[model samples]
Target: MFAGAVRVGTIDRVGIALSGLCVVHCLTSAIMLAVLASAGGILVDHRIHAIGLVLAIVLGMVALGRGIVEHGFMMPAAIGGLGLGVMAGALTLPHDSGEVVYTIVGVAILALGHDLNRRAVV
Candidate 1:
């Protein structure tokens, strides 16, 4: 799906877009759950979070890994790895136990890493 973007060195941009989507999903889920009691099942599904995290990890690894290889720098990949770890940790939190906060922070960090990766490449 993102072949063209990746080939054109826009992987970081794609990662940033995914990070934005993750943030939107997190906020929307929180709002939906608060506003509609019946929205819990769909919005709070663990599978969704798991899938999102996996996507982030794969994209981060690819983009940051390539960035490090090209620029001979590891900071972007390190930061991305740390962000992925935080996001994974969020999954371990109990419901209503500040999971959203962790996820959002992780996503933000991940986006920053992608931005750094882009800069390194340039």
Candidate 2:
């Protein structure tokens, strides 16, 4: 019903959806990280975080795989979509003014990764 109410070809619905998704994404990421930190900091170890990073990247690629199978040779844009979300959360985590430099670097790397993924689509 809600989906049907959304008009096609109008930015109205898309903008609302994106905004809502972003709000939820931010809240969920914050809560998850907090829980991880409080519960013995599951992500504290550099080696474990490295593994998690690899897993996250793989999941993004898997999303692309699913998209490729569904679209059948169309632009597999899933990786960029996922990478953008990851970067968005990562950038906000530090919150400290001094971390702005690191956030900029993360965003730049994210853009580069997204661009590479998008370009590689066949």
Candidate 3:
């Protein structure tokens, strides 16, 4: 049981870190796009967003799913799901400011969910 908890904790930490990175990437990409119109686009490619979204979905599922099972709290999972949905929806929209806004909002909400999940475990 202790070992399982430790593993889950590690997963939660990684999910949290990844969520933070997603935020940083969104913000930095936006700023870069504004400053360096030509080169910045390269930095904020669709592939990068796709990769981040994939990681977020996978990690969010593992950590949040475990937390929900252990704590029996659905809020964390609900929030995380909503965040993931928003992030995924961003991909379907035009790759403009709207997409950036959605990504930022989604990542922030997802990170909050991860935080909640971590707390629930304790």
Per-prediction TM-score: 0.91, 0.32, 0.88
For residues 40-95, write the lDDT of model 1, one tens digit per residue. 65977999999999999999988988887777789988998889999999999965
- Rank candidates, lDDT, best first: 1, 3, 2
Q: Count the backbone clashes (under 3 Å) in each candidate.
A: 0, 0, 0
Q: Rank order by TM-score, top first?
A: 1, 3, 2
RMSD to truth, every model:
2.8, 10.3, 2.0
Model 2 error, position 105 (Å): 13
CA lDDT for candidate 3: 0.84
Tens digits of lDDT, candidate 3, 50-110: 8878988988888888887888899999999999999999999887789989988988888
Off by over 4 Å in 1: 1-8
lDDT of all the models against the reference?
Answer: 0.85, 0.41, 0.84
Q: Residue 63 of model 3: what lDDT? A: 84
* Candidate 1: residue 96 Cα off by (Å): 2.0
